[model samples]
Target chain A: MLEKKTHLNLLYDFYHSLLTDKQRQYMELYYYDDLSLGEIAEEFQVSRQAVYEHLKRAEELLHKYESQLQLVAKYEQRQQLLKRMGAILEESSPDLEELKRLVSALKNVD
Target chain B: MLEKKTHLNLLYDFYHSLLTDKQRQYMELYYYDDLSLGEIAEEFQVSRQAVYEHLKRAEELLHKYESQLQLVAKYEQRQQLLKRMGAILEESSPDLEELKRLVSALKNVD
Candidate 1:
């Protein structure tokens, strides 16, 4: 459950702009602000079931976006490559060839 | 019109996966393959008007994706930065601090 939350949070960061304003609002309140579903429903003047359905649909869209776009996956890949390159750059005598390969890989990411 | 085509082509490359198979096919046929709308319509046994609308909607969605995500913008930015950094790395004594700053900026790219 925690793993799913973490994944959803990362996905939400990437694709939240594609969601409806109300969906974004509910997601922020429920995930970031740690509001209970009941709290979100009450604040939004909707039934808890309605709020749950909205969140579920919003989440499904986020997953769809990820499956299609892979933006977050590409992002994580680039970050990993950058960290390795940074470590190499900090060496006294950086392996220029290896750095070049890393840069090439970075360019080809996604 | 040519500029818009070029821009849309690039956007399509980035976001085509988000579009439906039919949308992708129409886009590729119209843009990449340079098939006339009437030709595409005939190929698919649809009216030319329907083909035009599908292409229009697909193009609009591509633009919307670009506006929301800016994946192409970030990709271009990183490419430029990498080119500049690559040039420096080729020099006998690369500016380590400047390279570090570039790396840092890359890490922060959306």
Candidate 2:
């Protein structure tokens, strides 16, 4: 499982780096758009396997990127920090500097 | 700013779709791992501008994925829901069915 995750991370990184415009469109349709593989194939005038390949490759690419860079991990960390900050803000005694620092850190991500 | 953001989004998606293995490595060093641009350039034996360009392009690609599929948006929604659920769990009267449903929904994201 660890090996698989590492492989997936490598694939993810590669996918992030080297995607074509059309491939990206297809990926968005399948993953983010929540379209079925068959639907994506039809939209792209391709076979189901081709669509599957695209998605599989895309997943691989994302994983590749993640392994090398751990972007997802960092993003998750930042998110957790944001949540903690939110919780802190809800408290009666909020730390102003801490809030500012957290906000600045988040802004740096963009 | 909005136009810049849109452009960044497109770039981000494109980056996500098509990153090279080496590029992914550089990106992780720069973004998630928080390596400075200069440090990444030195490690890769690339110029500072090259590193900058790589980082810029990578950022663009991430934004593109976000805009096209709104994965970040969906993730945020899930996080918010989780927070709410956490809050609910802390409440005196917790809803068991709602908790189960929410957990099920989150599990589906993976």
Per-candidate Cα lDDT values, in order, are 0.90, 0.60
Instruction: List fnat per candidate, in order.
Output: 0.62, 0.00
DockQ of each: 0.72, 0.05
* Candidate 1 wrong stretches, greater than 4 Å: none
lDDT of 2 by residue, A1-110 (tens): 37765544434443444566666777667655679989888877899998888767767666655564455665555656566655655566655456546544543442
lDDT of 2 at B27: 70
Give the per-residue lDDT digits (tens) of candidate 2, residues B1-110.
37765544444433443566666777767645779988888887889999888777766667655554455565456566666656655566555456556545543442
Each candidate structure's count of clashing pairs = 0, 40
Per-candidate iRMS values, in order, are: 1.2, 9.3
Worst 10 residues of 1 chain B by lDDT: B1-10
Tell me the deviation in Å of residue B76 in model 1: 0.7
